[model samples]
Target: MGIAEEQSKASAALASSKTTSSSRDSASTAPAQRQAGKIDVLIQGVALFSDGYNIQIIGYMNTVLAKLYPKQMTTQVKTRLSNSILIGDIFGMLLFGLCIDRFGRRVGIILTTLFLVFGIILATASHGATVEGMFWMMVTGRGVAGVGAGGEYTVCTSQALECADSTPEMRRRRGMLVAVSTNAAIISGFVGSSIVSLIVIAAYGGKPSDGIWRICFGIGIILPLAIFFFRMRLNDSEQYRKHAIHSKMPYWLAIKFYWRPLLGCCSAWFLYDFVVYPFNLLAPTLVSGFSKDQSMISSIGWSALVNFFALPGSFIGALLMDRIGRRQTYALGWSIVCDFGFAIGGSMIQLKNIFPLFVVLYALFQTFLSVGPGDCNFLVSSESFPTPLRGHFLGFAAAIGKVGAAIGTTTLSEALASFDNPTKGQQAIFLIGSAISVVGTLCVWFLIPDAPVNLEDEDVRFRNYLEANGYDTKEMGLSASNT
Candidate 1:
């Protein structure tokens, strides 16, 4: 055969292979549609709780660590902590994605929990080391723990969304799991900060402290234990079976083909974290500017007490998401975030009395920004990709998000140093974050396209994407949506 004929034959073979796979997938999904049932809320709740717990641990680690070694900890050192954790987080994200695909969610969760336990204990023990050695050891432990956090968010979101019945009504129910994770995250920050404060006060008698942070580190092991036991009853989503039979594509190829959706998802997540990390960490550092002692107490107080309000904020955000649609919900949340940036700036300028009004406005702004974007970001992430690639996509977004987080933490330190007052620096960071949130919202509104709200739609989109690219998908007839 001539070169053109050979090329044509190769193309035909690839097309035939794709069609055959599509038909088989369609056949496999029929059973899933026939037996649509609600996923157990208790199981998903445990997964979400664990996910929130890990984020809490990470969210507070740098602040708590800096407190422990006040004389030795510089802005540069703190930035390293942030960057190191992100590095570890990326590895964990990738590892979780691969494990979930190959070994299933239960196995993946179980394996990662083991890592969390080990990492936390090791980090806590680092407190005993000399300052120079301890910093590096603590960084290592956090990195490992971050990996566990990455897994929890990525795998749990995918698993929760997958197990829901795929009917339209059921799809809405599944989407609530995203809210569960977000609600838990906001609450955990409150809880973790409180826990850290109580431990510090009791151990150190309200003085400049270090040892109490070790207790904070050790406490990280508890949720993973609880989650592992609870997740024992959980099972893999029905969609995986369809993918196995229909796509006939190796899991890796399926993921590679869906990279576009993954890119959009990751970009959104990166921007979300860029704003969130600086905002969250600002509480402790900004407060520290007033007095070292007051800073710790104030951060602890806000984290514990203020977080009570975040649950309601998240619920409201979720309700709006269900009502207003994902794009509008995200746009509204980001707009609020942007508005708060100006509020923060104005409040800072009015600091003649260091007004109670400024403090109250800042806290409230943190609340809306915390709950709203968090709710929208996780929800969009959960729904953006199909079950087969969901975990990988989540992981990819998480890995990239960590980079944004590092930028947040690192820039926060610089902003603080450049301005004489830490509070002023914080106002600057908030202003910048607010601007980013606005841009992020616009990106979602104009550029980020919508996806199928049900499994049938998801299947059609997947099949269509392949077919348009000259791949046949006649074999996998499966397109059942898990309601």
Candidate 2:
């Protein structure tokens, strides 16, 4: 045969071999791919559970710690203690977000888990002869844990959303999966905290014990530790893997490209936290204001009961998110339901004669929050940006939201202190949160885009943009199969 004919034959053989090899790889990987979706959701849920559990556990510890160290538990000290974890959270969100963007999801998660474990251990083991020493140690530990939790917020949300986006069936139900996991975490936190509180009460006969708070903090570590190995085995999302070869856009460039979506996610989260965290932190106080006859346990129990309302709200919101759209669901929750609930509840809260009305209204307010922004915030944030910058944007948004949370908590505390009438002060805080929610609603309406996005399409678009901008996009293919 001529030289050209021999070359053609060699090319044909090479193509046939490549096709056969691809088939073999696919066959071997099929089972693992089938299992990946479930595993990803499970891991994400566990991480979120740890996050919620830690937050509530610390909240529950506040009163106990105050009673144990009354002299050192001044308003300033309490504020500092509360701010410690939040400050750490701010750092964690930014740090892990960058790490995930650079290193990949699995690494970011493992690192976050380790930080959480370390922080929990430190906080649990904290002890000192001086109140100052003990306080700072605990604060530092909590701060460290906050870092991990903050990272978890970004990494886990991004991972879960990316995984969901890869599976068509899962993608349609993404809102439900993300919201349910998050709401479940919140419920788990409350349940865990309540159980610990009951245990402390039982062990100490309604008195404080040195080990009570320690056990609570220690228990917070169990779930995270149990899942650490699994997290280590977790794979980066296929969407990310397909795009990982492309050089990342500069931070400023990524911002410029995604600023509108970022604004939507950040502003919505800020508003949600601005309303939710304060109400949550002050729940017992709010309940007490309405029903002065309730015991501490009764008050705690009522607070937990109120959280149940959020469960159904989340499911409803998830359904709405899938059926209607993320933007509408968010606006409905924030502007229509939550805004009205706060406005109406705040107005009625001052009317001491209609205490039951106030309680019912307050529960409704929480329920609205649960169904709307509460369940949808993570989903919107994670889905708004492309995979390469998703973590950074989500982390940044979460950090901003935490800022809102810190402000809300501080302002509410001050308002409660400054106003001679506690009821009026709490009512004022509610109005402020409602007003903020209104602004959030406006932001969502105008700033957030309502469109279905395919992750693979996004990656292709991003790669095309990169290629147009003179970046080498030849290294990675345009499509990645779900795994």
Clashes of each: 27, 0
Error of 2 at 24 (Å): 18
lDDT for each residue of candidate 1 in 1-483, tens digit (9 for 90 to 100): 343353344445554555755666555534433333454533555555544544555445556666666777877777776666566667888889767865567777787777777777777788435797888888888788777766766677666666663455667765455565444454554565566555665567655555666776676677678667756666566665554223344454455555555666677778887876665655555554545556555566654454445556676676776676776766776777678777776566565357456556666666665455667666666667655566666777777877888787677668767987666776687677777877777666764546456654454445545554466444432243332
Quickly count the clashes in candidate 1: 27
| Cα lDDT for residue 381, candidate 2 | 83
Tell me the TM-score of each prediction against the true structure: 0.82, 0.87
Q: What is the C-alpha lDDT of each candidate?
A: 0.63, 0.72
lDDT of 2 by residue, 89-177 (tens): 89999999888977788788788988999999999999888988888899999999999999998888887777777678887777777
Positional deviation of residue 391's Cα in model 2 after best superposition, in angstroms = 1.1
**Candidate 1, poorest ten consecutive residues by summed lDDT:** 474-483
Top-scoring candidate (TM-score) = 2
Q: Which numbered prediction scores highest in lDDT against the true structure?
A: 2
Report RMSD for candidate 1.
Answer: 6.0
